[model samples]
Target chain A: MRKTKTALLIAASTTMPALLLSACGQTPTQGAASPSSGVVTITWYAGPITGTGVRSTLISKFEKSHPNIRVKLISAPTSTNTDRANLTAEISGGASTPDVFNGDVIWPAQFGHAHLALDLSHHLPKSFFNRFAPGLAAGASYKGQEYGAPLFMDAGFLYYRKDLLAKAHLPVPKTWSQLYQDSRILQQKKLVRYGYVWEGNSYEGLTCDWMEFMTDAGGKIFSNASLTHSVIDSAASLKALTFMRKLITSGVSPSSVTTFEEPQAMAVFDAGNSAFLRNWDYAWSNSNDPKVSKVVGKVGVAPLPTFSQSQYPGYSNIGGWDIYVNPHSQHISQDLTFIRWMTGTQAQTILATKYSEIPTNYAVQKNPAVRRVNPVLNIVSKVRLVPRPSGTPSYPKISQAIYTNINSALTGSISPTAALKKAQTQIDRAVSSNSL
Target chain B: MGTPNPLEPELTNHASRPEKKSPGIRRRLARQGWAFALPALTIIAAITIFPILYSIIVSLNHITFTSQGYHFHWVGLHNYSVIFSNPLYRYSLFFTVIYTVVTVFIELVAGLLIALVLDKLIAGRGLMLAVLLLPWSLITVISAEMWNYIYNGVYGVLNALLIGIGILHTPVVWLGRPLIAIVSMMFADIWKTTPFVAIILLAGLQMIPHELYEAAEIDGANGSARFWRITFPLLRPTIALSVLFRVLQAFGIFDLPFVLTQGGPGHATESLALLGWQVMFQDLNMGRGAAIAASTTLIVLFASLLVLRAFRAQVGEEDLG
Candidate 1:
């Protein structure tokens, strides 16, 4: 009798959580807008509210409709880890705050191991997920599990002077070789000081720039899609690195390229100093801004040039943000609803047109109004989107290796071959060692 | 003509208490002391001691710093060994040492020279000190940012002035080169903090008895002789205290480099403090980060002790002999 009772207790304990989980999942999806549910103040950690009313209009509308759901926006500066660190601290300490968070384009891979974000694939409908751009949807998913929906998107673009190219009697450079040649001829004619400019700093931006070059030349950071093997020391990677070096040493790009971030590169090209610049689509708007730009109405946007045009217009490194639900949130259903509502068509349209947000929705990107505001969207709507060096838990470590060694080559501290070799070794070590 | 030191708050008790006080009374007094310090002691433990002990425990284990909580692999001394072997960490440490040593040395010499000049001026010294201290009183980030604008490649006043003066035929990117970036950082640090060092040294100068200089003049000694023999010898303790403070602060500096160069132009100015932050927060390697913090603490402790010993030896050279 004692043994039977003990076995019954053990079986009950083993299946209890599973049964509870199933019941929990069903209750949320089936009774999402249960009228009986009371007010919930769910937190949404996001970028600082800008003056453009992109977030404010959506939030006010959201609040006006959903009287019972209050979204407490925890604001943080853009392009900083302060907000992520805060969420990490709170959630890791088991605090059920920030029901929703605006995660960076490259954050999902790191957020995967932490189990801090809820898996949206289980809760969000496939129809809803299918509305997003395929690249963005894939970008937001880690290891076949969707954790968030893309908030908006941006892609790399090759910004060049239309007048300079027209005057020089040349078309926009279609390949890296062509760009080098055109930039040289333009510089020699005293039309521009430098031929090409890009972010070559030893930071995360360099990693993005390196990825752009690597993908353009048909190089991958890893051999497999799972990111298990580091096959970064490729001949194509060497060619790309060497080509970048030639741009600097051959005086096509200024030596200061090693210190230039996006803003600096934009400043250089927008000042009409460089013939071509590689930056994100934001530069297009900035170039047209009369207040900041000198090259208004004279700038032309094209895809980053590749080795050859047959494969695709050169790959555009994906730049965007996503919104994820916190695993430790008390109001998971409310947060999910908020995400869907926030990333909804109307809300995304308002955000896209008003705030210069490049919405990740395929429909929104095709919207005539958004394209009018952002002219580069016309070209970027069909460009190939290459993902950053991600998918592993140690994504930051791998990128650090790429950026640091590549910067060394750019600054002449090491040869291109040596830098690529060192980067490969470091990335391999980081990948294998970081894995269990 | 004589005045009591306002700094000594316990002077009354020190003068009134008998040297042969009873043991029971002393014990009661000690208990009273503890009663007074209880609140402060608890607060200190909560703020600093607890975190330090917790960090020590964390440094021993290999933690993943995940949301579910840390998963420990239990690698003792392995983290420290990894840091020692890692070239990036070594490079960061090497630059940190150079930064601390070079900045401190320059600040000391510059501070002393300025203090000496102020001492000789006898009048308008107050005005001079106020002027010198204006930059120090400004926020460090603001100063660093100002320096960054000056070091800007294209739209900077520095490049404009250099080109206009024919000192530079073409613009040189001050922040685009590693060594130049480090030097520019040092220049900014010196500009903002040399005043602080000067104030400390000035106080030391004031503490020296003027009669010694008068007697040295009577002995036919020159101005340099008086400074070397009387001033330097007498101001050893004050110099040591100030040196200790500067060394500790410089060893753990974060804001200036962070704001100015961001340890950039290829990680040329990455300090130990910046590295510690990147490890713990950016990379989320709290285990190794703790080890780095511990190592930096050890370095600061040893460096201060070495300074103290050398100062003690200097004091002994004249007073003991």
Candidate 2:
């Protein structure tokens, strides 16, 4: 009995280490095989698409064209965890199983730096760079090198209720003062709950909207490759912030706007309760969806209003996603091939015309098919893409400083001048500390 | 429970027989303990302890997400200094403390009340206990979403009820104002966590002997007097344990406020955990984020120690031992 017990203990001890080692080593492998012999599985992480069913249609087409290459589509979370967990796991584990990653435009730099993305300049023609809007090319570039191709482009535009404008006897607001006036008239007339709805919550979306106002007011957050100390605190930025404050405080915008994000603001506008909404191109399709939206036919798209006369055209913050190959991917050649095919003119057209994703390719943007699907393409052609301040390493820190101060100002926690002054101090400290 | 006789002949023979074989037996037992613990220990080390140590190392470095790859420079204490100097970080710290104190206090009081009510051996007591524990069993993420709808400005049941009762003419934006947003989040937390505390206390209530209460009644004690003299004293240890667990859980709160407010209505709801998440993911400042996370862990540890000390004081050292 004693001998048997001793043998059992020794055997258990020996097997334990083996079990642990096996558990640690069991990472999922990418299903990569020759196209002829086995199905070439390509995983794609995409954004939430509503109405048009563009993503599903595109997947079916891609699979049909290359019958051997099976496309596995996964939806990325709208929240933060999906981005953090998926990207971190892929980079840390050196796994390239997800052949195509739907990267945020702001993230290319971060991912590229982590050595998790493949440089697409090698696979595609150099002229591919020329096909996007001027500043859009920068969205996919890091340190003067192209890491990925722009999949889609989004520029902020003013979507308004045409019926409300007509009822209030107002034309589209040409300037900040005109916007405020129109909103006031509409509110007084009981045409809507407020004059406008916008994303005012302290987030990346808020920064995008604030940039449009700051740039249109002729105030820049940074200059000469470094944050311009006290420049964003200038008269122009204060003017823009003051106008925004007046609109909110004067009852032209509801208190709920303070908590609204992209979808929340869009939902209000689509419900026909708001006169104006400042959002991306994606809102166009949702607003035009006859089943869900009340003001489908009455929606109008125009450039965001301007404040300074010198700023000829109003600014629109560039927002969109791109596709990049993971550098650590074992199948680099295959990933590049996939990226090339996805961003090609043919695919871009299909994505734009079918899915409502504003194609990055200039040729696709001007394609007659795109115009037929969405008449707003003409306006998208004219709009310029404004790059985020976070294009540099110090951007996140800089953006936080700006948004924190702006949020304080908007919430009446601090005076605009005081907020701007404090913001300048914070920006200077961060930039100098980071050696930007 | 009887102690082994040291002078027994079998024990003496076993001790006197080669000491070398005894060492082997002891070694074998130690090895068995290790073998049983190794799998769990290895997993814990890899998933928890390793990341914590790695984060400390990363926090001391200047890391950026750029095109080339994670280029890092050793910049000791720089990230920590930034967090210390920033006013936003100060604001987040203040809000986290307020949230922790408010939520924990409310949950404790409400939990104690519910536990007292459920302590009576009423009809269908088992069913009532299960129903009381249902909220605790539900996943936090789902509850957060449900509460978000309740707090919604348009077509929310909360606002609808308030209006129906003629409380206000217009719908109040529960999550739109700064101060109100924090209060709203606290209410949600109190609703979800009070049940957990009740369950813990309920188990403690079951263990208390009925003889003690009977003796207290014979001593001419009233219900309130009996509760103070007999019940409260005995329940002190269980209450302390429950509060300690709650304080730790509340300190590290993320999902409730995150889902409901997204730290919004202008940074009013930004807790340490949410701020840490933003730094790590949104800003991609892993170094600074890790530093914040490390600091948070230390702060929570200190707070828990204080609570534990208070708990020991109430229960006395002998009972704890």
Candidate 3:
């Protein structure tokens, strides 16, 4: 009796584990079509466009139009790098719930090379790509295939306190030197605590800010268009970097700007503390919003100022999001439909007018009605746009090299010359795939 | 032997007879135990062992993701060589080690002092313990974010307080300079983890027999003498355990620095885990990332072993006792 009981217990326990293991292997039936209703559900992963339910609004609008499909919203992390990591793990691991995801505009080359994003050119009509503003469609392509559809456009703009500028009897500065002199006057007159605040933190945003200054001084990250060689240690870069450092030493800009990101810089400008803020298009609405801005009506937006040697408006680094389909997604057609609708006139108009996003749709971009709603949209065509050296998949590392070394110089940890030389060496290593 | 008893069969149940059945019973019990543990063991293998083994293999190969799946090209130690030769990786290694050593040392010392004081407290001990656990209980990311506000350069609370009290003539950018940023990050880490170390040491302190201290006191030993002779010697195993735990955790520091500075003002505060994450996810260099992870694991493993070996004699003696 005892022996039989032991045998029975052993059999039951062994089978229990097998049952558990088998149960663990099964995945949930997400993104699956309902057998009875014939309705399909797809997940869309996106970061916060606006805290005011923009995603849910868009989803409801889409679902109303296309009743056959249901869209589930998955809120992604606000940090772009964290979002990329999560998406990379999910797509690379073959999880297919997120049929579509919103990625950074700079991710096309890297995502395309890794096969993380599906080639939309293979699936969508060629005419679909033409709806985006000029240069946006090309920006969303890697090699010969388009991987993402540009959803919105963003560019750097110079935001100044009109009240402060007026108080100091200064016109809107058109050149870097002019802006510097004006800022000094504002600070010296006790009209403003600080002159300028921009993103200088050692992150992706710094790379964007660096590109503007570098290009304004005729400094190119890469000597050749193919991005095979880096000439970041040129004399032009030294001049640009030196001016940035002098801004701190001369007390025109706060020493703490070295730690500033978009929010911090924006906060300083919005609080009526700083005289100038270099930020993206969204700052126009943010600065004008009375709920958050002390200088609501006192702020004015203009194109970023260039160095004396360059033209009036300096380059604005292209910044925005792009929508892409996951290669592992089960609902490819539905994903494409969502992408098309998002970039369509109706949705683009909502984004532009309500949230003040610069629409990537060329029709909406050129619409006088939409441009009037968001003043930054009107100035976008005037400012020169420069693309980050993201033509290659190694752009992330290259950007890191630029931002970290440049940040060191900005912090006075190293000289501008040393920082540029180090950036050059690291960028070379990244291009050659020689370093981590 | 004198008489052949009726209970002779039971009485003669010698080693041979019982031992013969015991082996079969023991084997059956062992099998049953294993059957019951199989599910948990399988989960562990899947989650922990498999990833570790796969990460090591990945480190040895050039890995790329395609639509079909992952494609691996064997590259021997090329990835390791790349990271090892890189200055950034070298700096990260140096920074992580120094960070771990400094923070752990400070935490241990501070923890011991707190633990000693707590052990002697007569009132509100429970409340004190709960309060001390608060920092440790809060998530590292959340606490790090709080630290970010305190250390903000433009309008930080710390600056406001300092200026109000007239300690600082001007506000300092706490995370703007390399040295200051590293120190600030370490301070935040110490603030969060010291309480954990204290709690562990307190448990160890409680475990020591009160009579030992009493006996030492009766023998004319001073308070410091009592601690040095009785308290320190008996707390060796617990100290070893806490140190090992702290070293392992501190070496893999990520969330604090990641939130506080993102390994800036120029990668000055970058930890090994941060570097590995950046290389793997941000840069999409899987092989190099895996190499960094594998190397970190090996270093941690080696460090832990050394820590254990140093206290092996005391630990073994305690185990035997």
Candidate 4:
């Protein structure tokens, strides 16, 4: 019986591979038959960049206009890291099922380097590029090739409680120093527990906020795009970091801000416990909702403050993802059709007005309808977008080192100067090893 | 020689008999075994082994996420060297060890105490056991969130209760301070995991024969003395096993810390697993991430082997006694 069992096991193992191979041959025929019936299926994997119901409603409208095409929607995770992982896995698997992918602007370079995305440079008109904010087009390009079409963009801004400032008898602080003074006064009066709350966690959100301060202080991560060494250890960068540390030490901002990510900090500010918050434009809508926020209709928005008077104007780091076609897609024609339709003038208009997604198309940006729906687009229009350094293949590694050091500085585990120097050395090493 | 000859004749007769067996019967038996084992093996290979092997291979090279596909370079031990030399990685390892040791030690002692309390022939024994098992069955994510709410500085129940009773006049930022954050995380972990250990120890308590305790009592031993003499030695194996499981579980913990503190207040609560995840998923540097993962696997394997060996030694000593 034992001998029979052994023989049976060997025989079973040998035949299983043949069965699996035969099963795999049947899947593609099933997928191919759907697109031939005068019906094209476009699958989009994106995040809820705007309100929840907005993307679905717009897709529904697009389907209504073209009855033959069916649109399938997939939402990416709210976390940036998870979204990137999901997108990369899907692309690498070569499952053309998700015909279109919503990509972070930073990701296009990485994805383009892998040949996972189609070159959209020819599809996009030069006029379309001219209308976007100066650096946005460059943000979506890798090695002078465009792989994605920008859908919407985001930049950091300061949101302060109007009532708290008015009660404190203070005007909007135009510089970090002024903001610090005002915050101290508010805390002294017991009006708020914290002067400022922002993303200080060692994540991508922190990096975005940190870049705004670095730019304001006349420092850049890379002198040129090559990223041979970091410029973050400069005197300007040290000053910016030192000022941030002072905010925590001097009781302007809570020490807990060192652990705060976007949602955590947003929750603190939305609870009316904070006098000011540094976040993206999306917070404006959420903070004004009476159901969710304690300080509804009492919030005001402005540009992030700068430290130096002679530096170039204060800049907010540009965020938000783009939509791109998978290069390895079996249904390339159908995917291209979907991309064109989604970013087309009409779709962009509906998305901007209804969903508050800033349109990448310049023509849609000026539409009277979009302007009326979201007045905050005016802020987005003037916002400057900055790309991350180490844009080659080492972006994630370089960013992690930067955030780790910054986190150490924020937690009082290391001095700002030491943190910057360490970050510079680490980034320099990572770049040398990973750069092509 | 006579028995061997008879057996040989029987075996030869059986072997000749197999020629009459239907090929379909053999095929059917083979098919059944394949059907039984294929799903489990396939799942293990696909989800666990394949990824581990892939990571190992990737770690030896330089790979990066890009638009086309992963770019690779032959960097040989470069990634591993960088990780060892990096101070952040070193700190993460230290923290992971401290977290594992502290949590396992606390949980084992607490769990044993609870099990002893439950082992008595008291009223509502079944109900007590069920209630004691409740926290162990809860989803880790839900538990972490609940703890977060309880520890919230501004409106947390902990602060409100403490201040209301005049134990403290101010709210404490439970997750804000570095040392306090680590302790808070440990508190949350112990709350959720103590029940697991209790359940295991309860089974061990039930298995100890009552006659041994009766014999100890007859020798004029008190309850505590009887427990130390009769119950403690037999329970050592179970206790050791429970500690090993808990230690392994704590070593790879990710969700609790990720949801509760996200290895923050600046890496105070960072573990080896969290650091590996940050490298692999967050940084998208699968090579370095895999190296970290490989090291973690090796450490876990070494620790578990040592624990199992000790457990075996205790069992052997018990047998000799």
Candidate 5:
């Protein structure tokens, strides 16, 4: 009995401190010697997808090809902002974190500024980096250093009823003026209940819509390359806002558009209620599916219309997510290889085939098979893609300010010029603040 | 918390100790008491009080985590002044107050009527109670999504029903206009929460003696008079308690508007809690966000105190607790 009690005391004393110490684990030393384990494991964090996504098949193939590196998958909230917040919390805790992760297009600048993303310029040659679309590659850059590998691509398309346009004997609209003229003519002929519909809701979708208009009219948010001045308070932005309002006031778009996000607009358009709908390319496959839509085989797609003054026609906002490496991860070399392989032509083609993903790799996008599955892919490539101000850590706040003011202007609570001034003031304050 | 206690003198006097060894003995007893209470006190402080105190401190500083990790600097009253001066905070606060007052008033009156009707029913009272409670027991997300579909602009049943009844010539956009959107969200809340108020009032009604009503009827009193003299007076404390809690719950409502309209149509329906959450989590502006949180706590405490005082004026100091 005495022996057992003594043994219990010994065990308790030894295990007690270890249990207490687990609360604050040892800080991981940076740039330490790489682990010499038999295989390297790189954790990949992606948005919450349950079944076989683009990553699963790609990872299986990659594991077969590169036997030295193993892959682990983790799911995060589907929201980009939620993923950003969760990643920040995990990394700041100084504990285990995902080695590689997906980020929305706006994340490169914010994550790079926080020093969370590893710059990949030192890892890949300029020629290899040039394999992805130039417009998409630019979104993955910060301060002329590539921090992200373009994983997939998306662009807004102006989906119209080809039967209605043909009946009206109208040509495809190349510019905003012609779009408005054709929409009015179609409405007069009663070709559709509404001439056009788009997402005008007070959300991030509005930001995408606003950027499309602002960039088409040659308006940029910042005046200098150094991002010093707030010069978005301009007449060009005013014209963009006025045109959006005209879409409603002139009866070209429905008044109910104030409540629409992407899905809302898609639902109305799929119900055979509108002549033209502005949406992302994902809607192409869905609208063409005979099981779910009334407009199957009657839809035609084109890039969003542009201002007549624009040097480039039908310039839409760039919409895609990218993958970046976490600098704090110990398996930096393995993470880089994983990212390179996933973004390469072979994996891109699989993703396009399996998931209908718009391939970011220029060659995969040009593949005849991909074009057959996604007919809108070729038309999407012709549009110029202008990414928003994403290099700053205040990008989310800046986006909120822009969308809110534009919504207020659309609601007629404030004039377009007044809204621009208010937005500019808010942006300047966010920039001048000491912390994010 | 460590400041001098206001009741210390009364406590010592109530002890009625004047012996020579009393001071030393009291000191020993106090130390023993503190020793016994230490574990529980520590746990409570760590779990409950620590977060509130830390948020107060964070509210006074500008802090954010970068790749270098948390960088902090003192901003004193700057965060408070900035949020107060911003029009959005005022707008959110105003809408929150309006929603709380309007919902609480409607719920109390409606709940009383429901309880009265339930009290006099001859049969199927249990069935009616269960059916009424179904809304209260349903998950918030599922119900909000159901309401969203019902109010959908394209294929909503509400528009369909209204048009069929000839009340609307064409389909109306329910969640699009500002005032209508706020009302629509409130309608969903009323559907889910009025049963909760009704259940509480029903319990209060059951506790009243039936003999009091019989005596009033024998004394030639009518139904309305007896209700005013007996039932209304008897139900005052329950009404007070329910109103107090409903006010607080309504002020902090989030999921309904978040999932339903997202405080849209130009932020016509966003509550103070939603704005604080957006600042703290979404924008990652920790200091200003915590200040908004602390502001909410202060407002709630002040409102609760007012509620207590108003009830006391009507029903004297009693066991309302």
Candidate 6:
């Protein structure tokens, strides 16, 4: 009996910690509303969109428009990956709050496949989907079912220093080579400390940057609509990656660009260190803000440059958040109403004019008043847009393969050829669902 | 009552009452002890054991989620095979192992040196220890963000200091190159955790009697000789304990890399924990992710067992001596 007890004690102690090793991925379920209250409260989990008051303002306005439905805002982490992880854990474990969430535009396919999101296409009318700008609705769908409502639209744009270009007596660069030459000339004249900066970090942002460069060089990630195969190891992709590496080696961009995400790249440009920046629509307002920027009036917005002058405006990777509803939400009808109002004219106009977010509503996007509010909005129609290979539910893994390999090449740890080959291998494995 | 109790003699002597030796009384006392501890044990079992078993079960299945709930299809050992064949998983395992080995070894050595210095310190020792623990006191995610700024190539404090002293003409990207980025991450980890190791060693140092040093000095033993012969041998158990803790913590490192690098400059700094998180949450491949998690747990368990065995052997030797 003593021996048995001792053995049991030893086993429990040793294995106790081992058992603690696995994650207890339980999300706190929201308390349900009492039936007698007659007013419904829905939780909206949103990350910081542009500014501090955007969510609150939208919530207050939304509450005024619909008196019966009250919205509770649960601010999410700023890191997109962290936000995605939290939402996934919560919804997968069957927590019933966060009726609506603001998620990355690329998450629809993965979330839809997992059944974490409510199919908006089924609940909403066909005419409701038609109100969004063309391609926005399609981008928010997977397998012909829409899981998200496009809240706003965003695409990459070139933000350059008007002062630096004027000092070098150069016009706006029409092609990638022209931009490179202009950057070199400006750096040689000591007009700017660095020539160019963009998101080269190993994350989803890098995939977006890679998409722009690869598409400009006439390369495609998937050769077919099915996205079952990867064609990353191609000549056009090599040209794109090679040029990206050259920017670092030739001192046109700081070697640190390999570690840069959007914020860091933008900070360098706004601090008067770099001649050009590649970022989203919000960069226009950010660069023009006197408090956070040194180049307030000197920044000029333009469409991203192409590889050749003939394809003058390069492809800008489509990026923006979408509104998704929790499948486990208690108030599905209220969630639908919140999504509809958030995507409607009043909210879209406020987002476009006040926050400088690119509106997904076609009417607000084409509104002359909204166009006059920011220079980024004026050039939105001219830039070519390319979506990341997010059609497959394996998109997150596919993007990881793209960014990690491309970043390795950019950091000079591996050659562009080797990186592309590795990426191709990984992407193939991802699509096949045969490897982790 | 049918079996003899190995610890009965010690229990009876401690109790110092002849009647307490009765099997009924001892068994009742044991029952009461268990009754008092049951609540905490239940909580621990619920939180830890249940999830661990669930996670192991998850590893053996292909899972899908619908509006209704999860759908599990068992595919025994398939998930494990997938992770084994995946190059990313292999790389992450390799990286986590190397990182743990390098960081833990260096921390042990550095911590020993700091503890020794502080042990001999005559003035302001309390103040010094408090200051030493400042880095340890800071939340890891917050400190990682701080390190991010310090390692920033364009405007980093490290770059500015190096350039100001004319060490180089231009800044080096500390987190850009794969090799350097790994080194940078390791340095950040060592900087934050060395104090914890040092404190543990310091407590162990204090527990050594002063008479041992006196006895050694009278025998004409030098500083190095005394350290090896007296201080080191007596401190073997403490050293083993610290190593066990450090090894377990280091092997599962996540927050530092997740915040500072996000396993970047090309997956150079990706730890096993980070990779598991990416596979589980980001990819939503629950089966493969649980397999990664289960495998990580087994590796950690194996490493800690080796540590505990070494500790037990040292204790056995001490008893013989």
Candidate that would win on DockQ = 6
Candidate 2 backbone collisions, by pair: A112-B67, A113-B66, A113-B69, A113-B70, A116-A327, A118-A325, A131-A362
The lDDT per prediction is: 0.76, 0.72, 0.85, 0.74, 0.76, 0.87
User: Per-residue CA lDDT of candidate 1, range A1-436, in tens?
Assistant: 3322332232222211212121222122111233355887777777843333456678888989899887777675565454555565565555666678888878887776677678898887888888887667888888889877898888888989999999999999888899999998999999999899899877788888888889888899998877777878999999899999999889899887887888778898888889998987668767778888899999998888888868658888887788888786768888888988888887788777766667788888888867897677788766788888777668877887888788888888778889899898888867765311
What TM-score does candidate 6 reach? Answer: 0.94
- Evaluate candidate 3 and give its CAPRI docking class based on DockQ: acceptable
Q: Candidate 2 chain A — worst ten consecutive residues by lDDT sum? A: A14-23
The sequence of per-residue lDDT tens digits that candidate 3 reaches over residues B1-321 is 121223334434563454556778979977999999999889766655556667778889998888876789999999999889888899999999999899999999999999999999999999999999999999999999999999998889999999999999888999999999999999999999999999999999997778777776888999888787778877777888788878878887888888989999998998888888888878877788888887887787777767777877666544332
DockQ (Cα-based) per candidate? 0.10, 0.21, 0.31, 0.18, 0.15, 0.46
Q: How well does each candidate reproduce the native contacts, as fnat?
A: 0.17, 0.20, 0.49, 0.16, 0.21, 0.58
Model 2 residue runs over 4 Å out of place are: A1-39, A50-52, A80-85, A227-230, A308-313, A434-436, B1-38, B60-82, B313-321
What ranges in model 5 sit over 4 Å off?
A1-43, A48-55, A66-78, A85-95, A115-130, A144-146, A309-312, A326-331, A366-369, A434-436, B1-47, B313-317
Worst 10 residues of 2 chain B by lDDT: B1-10
lDDT of 5 by residue, A20-97 (tens): 121122234333223686687878888732124656777899999999888888777765655775665455545446
Instruction: Write one digit per residue (lDDT tens) for candidate 1, span B1-321.
Output: 022223234434564465368988889888999999999879755544445555656667787645455677788987888888887788888988888899898998899899889988978999999999999999987888788778777667899999999999877778777788889888988888889998999998987767667777998999787777778866676677667667767777777877766567566888887777666655667678777777776676667667767776554433322
List the candidates ranked by TM-score, beginning with the highest: 6, 3, 1, 2, 4, 5
* Lowest summed lDDT window (length 10), candidate 3 chain B: B1-10
User: What lDDT would candidate 3 get against the real structure?
Assistant: 0.85
Point out the worst 10-residue segment of candidate 5 chain A by lDDT. A15-24
TM-score of the second chain for every model: 0.87, 0.86, 0.90, 0.84, 0.84, 0.90
Question: Which of candidates 1 and 3 is the stronger one according to lDDT?
Answer: 3
The digit string of per-residue lDDT tens for model 6 on A1-436 reads: 3322333333333432222333434544774665468889999999878887899999999999899888999999877898988888888878887889999999999999999899988899989999999899999999999999999889999999998898878999989989999999999988889999999999999999999999999999999999988999999999999999999999999999988999999899989999999999989999999999999999999999999899989999999999999988889898999988999999999999889899999998998988898668889999999999998889998999999999999988899999999999989998896968
Report the candidate with higher lDDT, 1 versus 4. 1
Residue B298's C-alpha lDDT in candidate 6?
A: 73
Give the Å error, residue B8, model 5: 31
The DockQ score of candidate 5 comes to 0.15
**Candidate 5 at residue B238, lDDT?**
79
Second chain TM-score for model 6 = 0.90
Residue lDDT tens for model 3, A1-436: 3322332233222211112221222233345656367788889999888554888989999999999889999999888898987777667766676899999999999999999999999999999998999999999999989999998889999999888888777899998889899998988898889999999899999999999999989999998878988999999999999999988888777888898989999999999889999999888888888999998899899999989735888889999999999988887888889999999999999999988999999999999999888888889999899999887899999999999999999999999999999999989999896879
